[model samples]
Target chain A: MAQIRCTDLTLAYDGVTVADGIDFTVNAGDYLCIVGENGSGKSTLVRALLGLKAPTSGSITFGDGLTAKEIGYLPQQTEIQRDFPASVREVVLSGCIGRFGHSLFYTKLQKDLAAYHMERMGIADLAKKCYRELSGGQQQRVRLARALCATGKLLLLDEPTAGLDPIVSRELYSLIEHLHKTEKITVVMVSHDLEAVMHDASHILHLKKKQLFFGTREEYLDSEIGKTFLGGAGNA
Target chain B: MLEMVFEMFTYPFMLRALGVGVLVSLCAALLGVSLVLKRYSMIGDGLSHVGFGALAIAAVANLSPLKVAIPIVVIAAFFLLRLSENSRLKGDSAIAVISTSALALGVLVISVGGGVNTDLNSYMFGSIYAMSGEDVTLSLILSAVVLFLFLLFYTRIFAVTFDESFARASGVRVGLYNMLIAALTAVTIVLGMRMMGAMLISALIIFPALTSMRVFKTFRGVVISSAAVAVICFVVGITLSYLLDAPGGASVVLTNLAAMLLFSLIGMVRKS
Candidate 1:
């Protein structure tokens, strides 16, 4: 069964159609990369998938029992959030709120889960440290741990490596790859770095203005548009 | 100090006013942290103007201001929320339009009422010396309601205030929560008006939150510390007003401002 399926999706703001007649499906454990230029509706599509924005004309059907609590999301980090006053532990604990919503108090089990995810993300030592005092890479790792605590089955990251150093970006991608392989979690990522995405992504969704190309990486590489777009690396 | 305390307790109005002031200040401090963080600190100022307008209209109709103010400010808050959701107006612009119009309408109503002794001075700048028992009761009830709601939705509110999109993605209803916050702001503005008044109410809401943020590491800490600071400033300011024979409302606001400035200076020194 498909983890997420969108049929004939159309999205707009103030009657201006940003994306129209879009269709996509993601099976369990599939790694999909969405690549596009600015204003190509990458964020809009993610918002629609997360139920933040209602598509104008489409049906988005999640698998049975797969609610929002089962979907991890890593949105783009902003400068304002970097200076926000919170500890790493507090931020990560927020992720567990989906499961523990308004319970008056958090149980020991929830704390353990939050700690486990922080440890898995290699930030257990920084749990009590101020979030703003952390390095950018460390912050991103904490954010990932937060998302992981919220959901374990599917991870959706929106431009997670946009402003990081090249080494940090590579490390982030490797960490994502490790999660994907080890946990068999479905990963849907939006990124502009085509080379890194091309190497790791099993499938690609290349979006242009009102156009979409969805296929396996091999199929995408063999296409004429792929060759033109990827500088003949389609043959690789 | 002992004599002043005995005198204060001897006067029923003074005791009632002090109770109202402390309760309203505590509620305002609790909600103010989120407002400051979201950069909507002016919301209290705007909503209080709406409350003032309602109070003036209620006076004209010979109705209770509390009853009239609650519904009017709540309706106006919903309208402000709707206008903010409209991408064209922007949040600050919406607040500016509503608040300015409401203040003008309130002043106009007062001017046309045959120059009667509307006691508009108290509403504009507060007059704790004339507070009644009814005012204290109203404030206590409103503060209790706000505290209960805050406790019930603390986690959801934390998520929405920190990162709205993340909260929405986690299946929390961002729009509902936003509306809830606006409604609470409206109620708090009305409840606080009898003590802080409309014009200076925003200061009461913003200053304590700012001072606490310099040292507190968590949202809950910010709320608690700000509330404590607000209560202290109110008590000290009231005492100073009695001893110095100055205006109580101005004294209170100035005390809060001094505290904020002192905290900021300390923070700068530590950083340096």
Candidate 2:
């Protein structure tokens, strides 16, 4: 069974429809990249998938033991984070907040889990450092480590490389791809970066306020819409 | 100076004011870190205005002010949170509208009930002598509750304040935690109003956090320093106010202002 299935989904807010008739399904170990232009409801879809916003119509169901709470999320950075006073360790440990059902503090096991992910993301040495003091790439790595701590099964990342330069963005993409291959974690990424999407994603779901295409990477490469988008995207 | 401090401590009213002031300041500083970082610093000010309006209504109706004001201010906090989350008028605009309306309502009610008297003056600028034993007891209990809840959910609160979307996705019940912060702020505002006044109570909430943020680079450091700053300022402000015959709330606010400037200076010096 598919890990997540969204059937005929329509998203709207403030009396305005943003996207309509969105349909997709993610099977286990699938590397799905959602590509779209600005205002194409890509963010809206990410929010819906995380169960933060309800769809205006249709349904989203999880199978293969997947639940909304179990999907690790690496959200885009916000203004609040720019000057936030928190250590890398503290921020990463916060990802384990969901595991504390009724406990007031984190357990030893959760701490170890956070530590492991931080080491995996190569940020263990920076654990005691202030998060905001780190460079943009390092900050994203810390966030990614936090996301890994949240869930070991799946990840939902929104524009994870929105700000970094080409070198750092490529490095982050490679890290994500390594996680996908070795850990066998399902990935759902929202991005505008066609280069990374073309190089890494196993499946593509293109959007322009609607589902323009949803198919395998080979199928997408051969499709007319994909060719047009890739050409237009490549020039820019 | 030591003898003067000893003299001030001899009075029963002074003792009560110090006790309540310490607890209220501690609660405000703890919540302030999250509020300041979340850009909801003005929330404390807004809720204090709602508290004032509630106090006015209670005075006119001959009811217990704390009892009446607590629930009204909490409900208003919830309303403000909901408005900011969903309404067209987002955060600061919503807070401004509600705060001004509530302040106006308070003034209107006070004037209709005859005129400004010692009760109004005491509530507006704050008088240490206004800290009745009963008010102290209530403030103690309420502040204990605020502190307990804050510590119990400290990590969750940190998560929600830092990143709401990620916290929500991680199954942290983001809405509940946000409401928890709002409700605690309401209770702290009401409790501090008798000692700090509605006009100046939010200084207790904002100044220490901002001052600590100037020097601290970590959340735990910021939180610990904010609490210490709050307690020291309260003690100093109370002492200065008693000695100089100044309004208690204004004295504290001035003390906080001085600390903020001093910390900013230190931060700049360290950077250079």
TM-score per candidate, chains pooled: 0.94, 0.96
Output the worst ten-in-a-row residue range by lDDT, candidate 2 chain B.
B114-123
How far residue B147's Cα lies from its native spot in candidate 2, in Å, is: 1.4
Clashing pairs in 2: none
- Per candidate, native contacts kept equal 0.52, 0.87
Q: Which ranges of candidate 2 are over 4 A from the true structure? A: A14-16, B87-89, B115-118
Q: What is the DockQ of each candidate?
A: 0.59, 0.85
Q: Which candidate is the best by DockQ?
A: 2
Candidate 2, residues A43-144, lDDT tens digits: the string is 999999999889999999999988888899999999889999999999999999877788879899999999999999999999999999999999999999
- Who wins the lDDT comparison? 2
Tens-digit lDDT track for model 2 on B75-108? 9999888877674347779889899999899888
TM-scores, chain B, all models: 0.93, 0.96
Stretches of candidate 1 above 4 Å error?
Answer: A78-80, A101-104, A232-236, B85-89
